[model samples]
Target: MLLPRSYINISFFQPPAFLLIGIPGLEAAHGWISIPFSSMYAVALTGNCLILLAITRTPSLHQPMYYFLSMLALTDVSLTLSTLPTTLAVLWFDHQSIGFNTCLVQMFFLHTFSVVESSVLLAMSFDRFLAISNPLRYAAILTNNVIIRIGIVIVTRATVSIFPVPFLLKRLNFCPNKTLLSHSFCFHPDVMRRACDDITINILYGLYVVASTASIDSLLIALSYALILRTVLGLASPRERVRALNTCVSHILAVLVFYIPAIGMSIIHRFGKHLSPIVHVLVAYVYLLVPPVLNPIIYSVKSKPIREAMLKVLRKKGQGS
Candidate 1:
């Protein structure tokens, strides 16, 4: 397909289609690498689906904490879907060319859901804090109606915040040879770097969104945990304290599973220029793929209710079969 052309620097450039790169220095092993990537994606898809199924089918999980968890599961599934096609196309078929508008669409959803995930985690931390600090008023504070409003705000904030990114990139002129991206997906930084025009606005706007969402969310999550700790410590019963602390274990694991690789990827991009290209690519893959694959497992092993619900779902299917 002939992509839209941009006349820049007295040269005809197909600025609409950008080529995506598989793992650098490991192109020869992309086929071999895809085995694990496909497996991880499969696990992520199945695990998250089960979480959603369990939440929806089980009546007891219709509380605020589980509501936020269901939101997280949906975001994870959306993130996986957004990146899976291009990633597999690059890895399995060695197909890397992506059209401009399609790339923009992918970038929008990719970033929007990522920010949504961060926001959801922050909300979950708040839910934990409320449950621990004010057990009596937890339901009153985060009622079903309140949770629905929060969900709306999460989606709206992410969409509004990230909506300008593609338009900003659209205004820039991309040079033909510079259209090769570092990863199998179209990332903002990767795509922005290809532009021959000024991108100070794009860079600044990207930073603004990051600061507003992930950075701020991280601080708030920490604050919530600190309060939860204080509240738990004040409890007279040692067993009660342990149980309260234990409730947060799954969330802590989820946060670590998410932010560590995300921060690692950011560090690699900004400071790890001296590192191998493979390192950057590998970290990017982990950042995008790991959390979804592990979150369901974390909750299943930690939260007895969710595990029981999931098992009940499986048994029903088994009996039906």
Candidate 2:
């Protein structure tokens, strides 16, 4: 019955390796670039964790909006962590090689967290719409159970959409030796494009997945905001309308921080045709990394409770020290 800790704590390390690429023309600057990237990573990690902690410790933040925010914070953490290691490796140490299965696993988490974040933003929009348009019914409409159910559905949707991608990619033949990737981690589109065999199915399926998940999510979010605007306009009191919209400023900023760069990257990948390598790398960084760093700060500045709670935490730490 005696098992050594090492025996139980085994690691399935990289079995096969795929090379990851740093910024192409800026290879000499990888070290320089990594400094800012590492700083952002520190901010993102600390900020998201603090947000989660503030929400968890403060009983007042247990409402539906904060609950959904907790979801967004969790997603941001996962999204950054999924790719940051390989990214830092490539940028800092030129440790660009990654295993095939590990790459697939990374791709799965990256896409999964991407979809989850999108869904959480949509849910946050819905939360604001309900709070503004029908405050009386907001609680009845989105009870704690309902929010929990929504989160489960969002996670389930992301899992189903992204689960098949790696398997599909596995079936393809990568020819002419080691397949090089454009980013520091495995991107499904980037990986699939390198396969030497027929890729029609992958292309079609990729498009289908995008349309079904992201396209629909985008449309629904826009529709929710449109309804929110219409409802706000109808409120007779100027102060009331202003206050209502004020609550939404942080969410709006979060949405823009996430979607705008993501849209730019999609456009570049699908149609921009001759985008520069640095451009793509920068866009990807903006889309994936910025939100995690910005979201907690946005909420702290915009939401009074979060700011007070964070200050209280810091004061406690100072006293304890």
Q: Which numbered prediction scores highest in lDDT against the true structure?
A: 1
* lDDT of candidate 2 over 24-118, digit per residue (tens): 98899999999999999999988888888888888988899999999998999999899899999999999988888999999999999998999
Give the number of the best model, judged by TM-score: 1
| Model 1 CA deviation exceeding 4 Å by range | 1-14
Assess every candidate by TM-score. Answer: 0.96, 0.93
- As a whole number from 0 to 100, the lDDT of residue 64 in candidate 1 is 92
How much does candidate 1 score in TM-score? 0.96
* C-alpha lDDT of candidate 1 relative to the true structure: 0.92
**Model 1 lDDT tens row, 1-321:** 433343444543437588999988889999999999999999999999999999999999988999999999999999999999999999999998999999999999999999999999999999999999999999999998899999999999999999999999888877766878888998998889888788899989988998999999999999999999999989999999999999999999999999999888888887898998889788988989999999999999999999999999999989999
Assess candidate 2 and give its TM-score to the true structure: 0.93
How does residue 265 of candidate 1 score in lDDT?
Answer: 88
Give per-residue lDDT, candidate 1, residue 285: 87
Worst lDDT window (10 residues) for model 1?
3-12
